[model samples]
Target: MITGDALLLRPWREADAAELVRVQRGDAALRRWTGAAVDDEAAALAWIAGQARGWETGDRLGFAVVAADARNCAAEEGELLGHIALKDVLSGDGRAEVGYWTAARARGRGVAPRALTALTGWAFGRGLTRLELLHEMDNTASCRVALKSGYERAGVLPAAPPEFPLDGCLHACRPGA
Candidate 1:
């Protein structure tokens, strides 16, 4: 687990399924950005399970961002604050892509950047030399988070139709930078 000043980043749990569904259903920005369809408990559970499998395979590492006040409680007992992950990881590769979304109620509290900073530090500690963060060009909030978390604007990624209809801003960061 990774702890920040006001957040705790830990593994996703089966108990988080209901909260995940509720957050995705109620947060329009999340739906718009992620295009996730975790509308029911079953779907949420499947998604969580996939995260676990990713851990077992070392291809993806996902974390459930929760309030630090719940640190003493079980991982699932914490108030769900957001989600973050390092995806597309390959063994022996020093690069990975990072992605995250904040719960609506947790916005403006520096949750995303704090959790991201902690995660980036942990990743680098594990020998990842570089990490990339990408977000739709219009997502100024994510842009800010990237900048605050030490990622430099690299370039624009051309749109890939259907899934990504808009160009995206590519940001990159390296250890100790």
Candidate 2:
């Protein structure tokens, strides 16, 4: 688990399924940006299971961001603030891609940047030399989070239609950068 001043980041659990479903179902922006479709409990469980598998395989690392004040509470009692992850990890190359989304109620609270900054520090401490953050060009909020978390704009990524229909910004970070 990662503990920050106002946030706690821990592995996702099966018990979080219902809350995940509710959040995803209610947040259209999240669904559009993440392409997440957890319309039911079953789907949410499957999504959580995938996160577990990612841990086992070491190719991805996801965390459930919760309010720090709820640290002593049970997983179900904690407020689910958001999700952040390091995906497409290439351990041998010391690199990975970072992604995240904040709960609607958590927006404007610095949730994404705080969680992302903590995660980035942890990743570097674990020997990851580089981290990449990508988001659709229109997602100015994510762009701000990336910049705030110390990721510098690297380049522009061409659009991949059907899935990513707009040009995207590519940001990168390295230790002390």
* Model 2 lDDT tens row, 68-138: 77545344346899999999885689999999998898999999999999999999999999999999999
Candidate 1 lDDT by residue in tens digits, 88-110: 88856789999999989899999
**What is the Å distance of residue 99 in model 1 from its true position?**
0.5
Q: What's the TM for model 2? A: 0.95
> Clash totals for all models, in order?
0, 0
| lDDT of every predicted structure (CA atoms) | 0.90, 0.91
Give the residue spans of candidate 1 off by over 4 A.
70-76
| Model 1: how far residue 82 lies from native, Å | 0.4
- Any runs in candidate 2 off by more than 4 Å, and if so which? 70-77
Poorest 10 consecutive residues by lDDT, candidate 2:
69-78
